[model samples]
Target: MGNEDFKQDKLIPIAQRSFASYEEMYRIVDFLNKTLKEKYNIMFGLTKNNKDGSMVITIYEF
Candidate 1:
């Protein structure tokens, strides 16, 4: 709607992650960590989703 809102949306988005197994999840996390750090110079955090037993990776910019 507005320029400020658009910029905020670009900063953070709601995403969903589902994996068939823990190994797949770990692989994805590792890949993302490497890519983000090497290309964008960003670091991310991984956390466990207690409700669904899934993993969540959050990358934020300050």
Candidate 2:
């Protein structure tokens, strides 16, 4: 590693949140999983929960 190769740029990290209602969340999750399953034939789903009042969703495969 050379010192010249280490260049620091101004790239600020941002936290992204999906602020969707219960119905919208369900639709998005279902559509994504179904489309992916039918098209790519990958079996998976989106799991969601509330942690500290923040909604978090994760993709998992069985």
Top-TM-score structure, candidate number: 1
Instruction: Give the clash count for each candidate.
Output: 0, 0
* Candidate 1 C-alpha RMSD relative to the actual structure: 7.7
Residue 62 local lDDT, model 2 = 24
| Candidate 2 structure quality by residue, lDDT tens digits, 1-62 | 55322321222223234444364566776777668744543332333445544344554332
Q: Which sections of candidate 1 miss by over 4 Å?
A: 1-23
- TM-score of each candidate structure, all chains considered together: 0.44, 0.39
User: Which 10-residue window of candidate 1 scores lowest in summed lDDT?
Assistant: 12-21
* Model 2: per-residue Cα lDDT at residue 26: 60
List of clashing residue pairs for candidate 2: none
Give the per-residue lDDT digits (tens) of candidate 1, residues 1-62: 98645544555433544433363656766788678754654445567777777766666441
